[model samples]
Target: MAEIRVDKLHKAFGDFVAVRESDFTVRDGDFFCLLGPSGCGKTTTMRMIAGLELPTSGRILLDGEDVTFRRASHRDIAFVFQLFALYPHMNVRANIAFPLKAQGMPRGEIRTRVEEVARILRIAPLLDLPVSGLSSGDRQRVALGRAIVRQPKAFMMDEPLGALDAEFRELMCGELRALHDRLRATTVYVTHDQLEAMSMADTIAIMNEGVIEQVGTPRTVYEQPASLFVADFVGSPAMNFIPFRAALAEGAAEVRIDDVAVPVPPLREAVEDSELVLGVRPEHIELTDPNEAAPLRARVFGVEYMGTTQIVTLNPAGGGTLKARVSSELAVRAGDNVGLHLRPERLSVFRKRDGRALKSRLHEVPHG
Candidate 1:
């Protein structure tokens, strides 16, 4: 396996930029993910790293050796596409053995490696079957098997399970992560799915437009997003933003919402903006009775039952609608008045000007 380093990598098509001057490293044997929405340049970034696309500027290093301009075939990197790129004319065994055969390995060696990959993928029984006859999941396994058989320096997967059904996609995610752990292979996976990145990546790079927004562990990004785009993009229900105007000094412990003082984590930086945004995840909000003298009050608008938990959507007295994940047993109904108690330490404050998060104690702690 190889440690991949991308330094000031940039890509452009005429006047439009696909990837800006991005810099991030994929440590040897790490499952790093480039996560973002469609046309956010994640797949483009992965392509550049895999040598499938040339960077307009900057360098790519594999284990300290520069390979920025290397051809895709010369990079010793295996790429698995979203749609399984298999030869319908060949059987699964042949597809798996193709790479080794192209390298002129002995027939016996090819057979051993092919069988080994088949067993690892749990597709040994399907090895002799025609590629066109296999199921989507099996074909995806075959695609993965083909990549694994190469024993390359690293693996680049561009939404390899994107073609499967939701249930199968979830199943493949676990399988793929397990395969990475077993092989200890350096892998870079590209996906727009937050669940996939959160569940699988050792480190995640959140991209927006052509720029890299933030890079951190799944927990770090989810809890302490560097920018508003990241905070909004990473979570399922997404973080709720409550807008207000405040002139807060560093070390201040509270802010006024609708003339009511609400406790917040002490601001590590001063905010002089006429407009600011307070972000809180649904799960961090506690709903209380409106008569209880809580800091914030809201009227329940809707309740979405989600098995063990229900998402309570409410209209805050201050302004804007926010959702709170509460126990399903709580008797919350539409038009019910409720007081919202936001967890102080878990709140994130952002500047509406540049959409950047204010440095707080939550972000100051070194993430493990």
Candidate 2:
């Protein structure tokens, strides 16, 4: 296994900069994922690391050696593309042995390696099936088997599961994690799916518009996003952002939203007057009694009954929409007036000017 590093990496096309000065290190034997939306430079960054695309500036290193200008074949890396890319005429065994055969391994050793890979991927039964006859999931396994047989320094995959159906993709995610544990090979995966990255990666770098917004473990990025862009992008239902203006109530800080003065912790005096955006995840908001004494009130606009949980969309009395995730047992319907309760500790406040979290303004107080 090799530790991969990219320092001050940059890529541009004429006037368009596809990647900024990116700097990060993928530890040896680490399952690192580059995650973001389309055109976010994740694939471009992967291409550079694979030696498929050269960077305009910066160096690429493997195992402490500078390989900035090395050719793809010289990088000692295995690449699995989004498409299966298997030879239509070759059977599973032949396809899995192709790399070893190209490297001129002995006939006997190639057979041994092919059987070993097939067994590992649980495709031993399909070893003799032609690629044209294999199912999509099996074809994906063949592609992975091809990569595994080579025993390359690191595996670089670019959306390898994108072509699979949702159910197959979900299964593959778990299998990939298991395979990583078995081989412990360094892996750099690039994908636009947040769930895929969150499920399989030991570390994830979130990219946006060619810039890396945040890099952390799945839980860390989900819980403590560094910027509003990250907070809004990484969640399933996305975070609910409401605008508020600050005020002082009983020597404590308060924010006025839709003419309702809701109490909040004190902000740093410097940013007291800055326009603020209150961010709360749908799962954190709870349903309460709909009464005049309730701090906030809203009318249910819609309800979606998911298998285990229901999503309730409400149009608050003030304006705008808020969504809450609650138990399916909670009977709610459209046009039903309900009270809303914000989980104070779970709330995030950001400066509207730059959409950065107001970490200094947060408190650790218990919620009522």
Candidate 3:
């Protein structure tokens, strides 16, 4: 029943708008993520929800109760910060029990709750270890322990995994997801990493420059981005954006890139022949032999051999550079001339003037 609804929330400091007319809902027990790059107002938005920052104009409702002006302590929400804000003088057990002790809970009750959280986080073995002696990952676990010991209505984690190494961060991502499944605690996690957000969040709100760009499940945002900013930001290696001209061919909307008349999905509305941006992910493009009749020709300028797959960079003869992710087994090398084919169904078209997506064929196209 701990659903959070934000209605037209706005925050401003001096002349700068940190957050702008934001409205979103985090469903009961849902793992929601506020995702965006630095200074994008994600952390600012979370601070407003936690009552750490006052709103300029908006309503914040938790479980049907209005709490816009409530103090942080009164909201009963726990915050796990980006830095492991642990007390170096205290042991793990003491750190986890601090919040309960602050509430005047009995010693016996505090001990019980601390141990329970320690077990859940799999840090029971290190309960007696001083926070100073712990590793980065362990310190993060202890910080989480302190937040969960109180069993707050919702958990607000701001880049809790940012300090850990890459391998350990991946491991923690799985552990955190599993813990969410068990607790089902309404969680608002803030992070700039799209991979982390995509892997963990049940719902994602992508933000940029004091505005929310898009909000949806990971697949929805990745496959059918609403704007050029979203389509470029959400994918790894980023989506390839190339300038093209739109036209009508045989009653279907089409775009020409390097004289290649590629059919595109139907637009929301037709436009006069004009410049448009063609958006496609590297993985969706196929590489072929130069001798073939493919519409595009390119020289392989670079090849990246990722263990699982290879990324091939090409300089198209017509213009801009293109990247294609292919299998490691593909015998492509630098300096090799290749034919490039656009998977028309996988393309996205955007109006060149404003960089807004005009059409997406995500549902109609087949993807791996």
Question: Which candidate number would show the highest TM-score if scored against the true structure?
Answer: 1
Can you write out model 1's per-residue Cα lDDT over 1-368, one digit (the tens) per residue? 99999999999999999999999999999999999989989999999988889999999998889999989998999999999999999999999999999999999999999999999999999988999989999999999999999999999999998999999999999999999999999999999999999999999999999899999999999999999999999897999998889999999888887787777778899977568888999999999976787767899999999999999999987678898999999988999998888988888888999999988887876535
Q: Could you give the candidate ranking by lDDT, starting with the highest? A: 1, 3, 2
Per-residue alpha-carbon lDDT of candidate 3 for residues 297-317, written as tens digits (9 for 90 to 100): 899999999988999998988
Per-residue lDDT for 44-161 in model 2, tens only?
9999999999999999999999998999989999999899889998899999999899999999999988899899999999999898988888999999999999989999999999
Cα misplacement distance, residue 143 of candidate 3 (Å):
0.5
Question: Per-residue lDDT for 3 in model 3?
Answer: 94
What ranges in model 1 sit over 4 Å off?
Answer: 366-368
RMSD, each candidate, Å?
Answer: 1.3, 3.0, 2.0
Please list the C-alpha lDDT of all candidates, in the order they appear.
Answer: 0.92, 0.87, 0.89
Window of ten residues with lowest summed lDDT in model 1: 359-368
- How do the predictions measure up, each by TM-score? 0.98, 0.91, 0.94
How high a TM-score does candidate 2 get?
Answer: 0.91
Screening candidate 3 with a backbone cut-off below 3 angstroms (N, C-alpha, C), the clashing residue pairs are none
Error of 3 at 357 (Å): 1.0
**Which stretches of model 2 miss by more than 4 angstroms?**
247-272, 360-368
